[model samples]
Target chain A: MIAAGLDPIAQFELHKIQELKLGPIDISFTNSSLMMVFTVALIGLWLLLSTRKAALVPGRAQSIAEMSYEFIADMIRSTAGKDGLRFFPFVFSLFIFILFANLLGMIPFFFTTTSHIIVTFTFAMMVIGLVVVYGVWKNGFGFLKLFWPAGVPAVLKILLVTPLEIISFLSRPISLSVRLWANMFAGHILLKLFAGFMIMMVSAFGVFKGGLAALIPFSLTLALTPLEFLVAFVQAYVFALLTCVYLSDALHPGHH
Target chain B: MTYLFDMFGYGFAAAASAAETVADYKGDQDGGAAFPPFDPTYFPSQIFWLLVTFFVLYFMLSRIFLPRIGSMIEERSNRIADDLDMASRLQLQAEQAQSSYEQELADARAKAHNIGATTRASVEAEIAKDVEAADVEADRQQAGADARIATIRNQALKNIDKVAADVAAEIVEKIGGFTPNTATVKTAVG
Candidate 1:
């Protein structure tokens, strides 16, 4: 495909196994699904080894496991407040999954499940739906009252209030899903593009000119790699923060 | 699909407004959701395992670990409070005992001083009585001795006169009749 000039996107095409069938459903394993299983197994093995023996003082692996636990716990406590304790499992799972997926994608052959919109969107939708549904369940129909401002003038209420609330509500999934998916997608593509550029530049322009041309893309890729690393962390934090906010809204839905 | 695009358009508009704040353009890629050839069926088994994992962790922490720690803290606090109270009570008892000891000591000292004074006064009076008795006895002895010495002196004097008179009488008889009554002659010459 690369030789045929089929574009970089096609070079990264994901195809499902059409041959495999499971009962009525065509459930065949894809790269993304395989990555999920691999991530789960890795986490299980890590935790199993880390917590095989309870220690008064933690060893290196145990300390890492403990730190990971405490880190997510602290994140939830700070962002979601005291009520965050109830959602520890969900939030921890999300953090571990995303953190591993992003880090794993940095490896050459590993697929990042988070890089796919469907997966990210599904995760986001579940969290957001939980927020809305649980908010309504907890607060009754008063959850919808979160959209309405209490002190607005009666005349401007319909004009001003409706659109803001709609936009805000709609922006939740867009922002949540897009943030993770876009970052992963962009980072991976940029790396591939730079690699392609290095190959093309070095070949098209001979040693002297190629070396000079190589420096630009080479430096850019170098700069972007660290930036991508930073983006991975930031996306995780933002995703967790959004979950926190949504959960907060569920617990206490309104300012006014 | 069309609704999704309209939603995207609205999102793009919002994104455009936010673009002034910062660049929101991440170049286009084919990362959007596609209908995969694989089944998108939910796994009931996976859901069952997930729930089991959540409940096990929750119960273990809540029932087992947290309760033990809570009780341990309670026990420690109770023990500390009991120790402090016991120490305070013991200190108070010790102070009371010390105070009584000091009071008894002062009382004993006062009683001893009074006893010493009375004993000293009695001893001094007995000594004065003994000295008075001895002075009386000595005066009496001196008077008796004076009297005996006077008597003895008088007797000796008498004997000496008598002998002198007799001698005088003998001498007078020999010489002439001058030896008259010696007593009368001695008396008349004296």
Candidate 2:
């Protein structure tokens, strides 16, 4: 049953924090934009404060900075090898932005930038775009070999395999974007619904009946909060992980 | 009753309206349900900020932050390399010092043995010379003693010859004036 006045979708609604138009296009900054800036600003501040010393032996801030740097570096190395260092900046920033966005969404009343398909798709497209451009630039004709792998049996080498591989390659952005968006969207929606259910039950019946009855949704919502937090981390990791996998293909075309 | 038909008609109409709501949400219109995120209206703003944020992050990480961290890593690795090199060099130095010490010890031991051997040879040579001198001195003294004893025996033999001659003469005179010749007596004793 629908909760009377409580709309679960209401939290995702976007409103302009500032209205600024530039030549017929509404360039107004929304809550999502604010969070993006905040995410960037926070990372910038952390890096600034962290490496200010630039010590030979790192302090705590520098250690954390180095750890995150090495973490992304190792991810690329394991997935894409040494050749993937060129895309390090993009992948690193992409992961941090998404992780922060998802975590920010978990905060009560904070907007989830990655929850939007447009946002996630944009990031995914950027990753794929980098892959394609870098692949073509680096590997030339061999880039297409990513789809048509080597050492396939002659029977499977017909038009069947090539088209399927191409389809899978193109589906990278869609799957990547949808996976992140759906996870965040569904988790937030579930949490919102459970919380609304508790509110509905409590209001409909007085203290003992309502409170005791409401306990189920309340506890479930409580439980879901941590799950949503987990989703936030896993989805970000998956997004970055797939980004690295795709980049590995780009860097090494025929080997995959 | 006709009222029942009217109620049925109203129920169908309500369902139809609900279906319309779904269709409208499925539309690409603005102010629709928040379920769809592929809305073109939000794409521009999101894209702009994503570009902006990503650009800043990449610029900072690549140009500023990452390189700084890279240098620190490089510094640490260099320090470790230096430390390792120093350690190995020190190890070699210690090995050389130990070997030289052993070499010196061996040389001193050999020298001590040589000195002991030379001293023993010199002492043995001195004892041999001293014993030879003592043996010669003892031989000379014994020869002298043998010569003296030979002289003494010769003198006693001569005296016995003379006394025998005299006694023979006396016995000749006393015994019936039967005196032997002195020359014959001397010859017999000799």
lDDT measured at residue A121 in model 1 versus the true structure, 0 to 100: 73
Candidate no. 2 TM-score: 0.81
Tens digits of per-residue lDDT for model 1 on B1-190?
4644444454355334433312212222243432221113423222322334334444444454334333444455677889899999999999999999999999999999989998999998898888988988888998899999999999988887877777777777788866588677577445
The runs of at least 3 residues in candidate 2 whose Cα sits more than 4 Å from the true structure, single-residue gaps closed, are: A1-5, A49-64, A153-155, B1-36, B73-122, B162-185
Model 1's DockQ? 0.08
The candidate that wins on DockQ is 2
Interface RMSD of 1: 8.7
User: Which portions of model 1 miss their true places by more than 4 Å?
Assistant: A1-7, A17-19, A22-25, A149-157, B1-190
Q: Give the Cα error of residue B115 in candidate 1, in Å.
A: 18
| lDDT values, one for every candidate | 0.65, 0.81
What would the per-residue lDDT of candidate 2 be over residues B1-190, giving only the tens digit for each residue?
Answer: 3643443343345335434533554553455544345556767887887888889888988898888887887888899999999999999999999999999999999999999999999999999999999999999999999999999999988888889889877876698487778897677666
Give the TM-score of each candidate: 0.60, 0.81
Model 1 scores a TM of 0.60
What are the iRMS values of all candidates?
A: 8.7, 11.5
Tell me how far the alpha carbon of residue A128 in candidate 2 is from the true structure, in angstroms, after superposition. 0.8
